[model samples]
Target: MITIEQYVGKWSENEDWTEVRQAYAAQLLIQVNKLLEAAKKAGIELKNNPNTDSLISGTQYGGFRPQSCPIGAAGSSHKQGQAVDIFDPQNKLDGWINDAILTQYGLYREHPDATIRWCHLSTRAPKSGRRTFLP
Candidate 1:
């Protein structure tokens, strides 16, 4: 499981990752961990290797995006600390994840075609409200 620092990363003025740390460190992190554990139990191995600019070495941003950071769209779940992007360079995750599993986890992800290198999973539903929706 990723730490709150890994989720918040080096963004905005919140260098301490205190912004929304309560939620991400507690609830969001648990959800992400359980989902990942389920995936691992299914024989899916997610490598911890993504070239991201985060404080945590050898880790990518788990979800939270500071407003000062230029990443996701405005009003994005990430900015609200409700999204997580798991590194999936091989695209194995996107291929393996289906609507049933998403429903089971109560999570949503960007469509496979839209997110090529990483699996963008979010606690927030997309505008389309699909388990896997277009970004």
Candidate 2:
């Protein structure tokens, strides 16, 4: 689990979000933990090397992205603190894992296209019963 400070540090540097940061951070962390737990149960190992900018480091873990970020998609769940991009530069996600296991953990990969290798998991609400694309 990452600290709220770690969660909001990058964003806070650009603006004063003291009061609202905790709420977003908490929601993000909850989902992150849930995913981690599910990975454990599914016998999947997450990227853990210190050099990797991953959820384990809370650095470039692909959590909230400021609207200014070039990669931030319009109306993206990432802007709402309800999404994360999971990727390991050295290895792809375990091939044994499937969509069913991710859904069971309250996470849905926003994109399933084979070319889009990274896992974009989100907790966006009012789900449109849609599961194959990022907003």
Candidate 3:
């Protein structure tokens, strides 16, 4: 099992995203590590080393830009450094994984009804509680 520190170290070593070594990135790294552990326990193989194409770089703070939607514009979460679009290796299993598993780790899929099919997960929570795009 990889510790969060180790995961963060590996992530920092990625030349493509070296800027993510900041404090905020470290926090996200810890959260992702926890998720990875849970996923491993559930027999799921998450692709941590996704291709560059799978990632959508954001202009705000190197977070991720959401695909354009009728509800709003792109790059919203980018500003807050709180959103990411995960690319699933198996398209068929993506929806189920996003809905059933990721939510347990403080992630929520956004804009399911939109044309683009990307899983949006964030650590952000509202005053009320954790929000879900589905139901």
In candidate 1, what residue range of length 10 has the lowest lDDT sum?
53-62
Per-residue alpha-carbon lDDT of candidate 2 for residues 79-115, written as tens digits (9 for 90 to 100): 6566665553333453534667566666555554532
Ordered from best to worst TM-score, the candidate numbers read 1, 2, 3
Per-residue error (Å), model 2, residue 64: 1.5
Candidate 1, clashing residue pairs?
none
Model 1, position 25, has a per-residue lDDT of: 43
Q: Which stretches of candidate 3 lie over 4 Å from their true place?
A: 1-22, 48-50, 53-75, 91-104, 111-117, 126-130
lDDT of 3 by residue, 1-135 (tens): 223233233243334333443444456545655765675576765544233422222222224322332333443543333555444444322434554565666654454553143445556553445445532
lDDT ranking, high to low: 1, 2, 3
Q: What TM-score do all the candidates reach, one by one?
A: 0.80, 0.66, 0.49
CA lDDT, every prediction? 0.70, 0.56, 0.44
Which has the higher lDDT value, candidate number 2 or candidate number 3?
A: 2
Q: Give lDDT tens digits, candidate 1, residues 5-116.
A: 5676665346534545456445666776788888889898777754654312224344666655577676677777777787887788888899998888788888989887
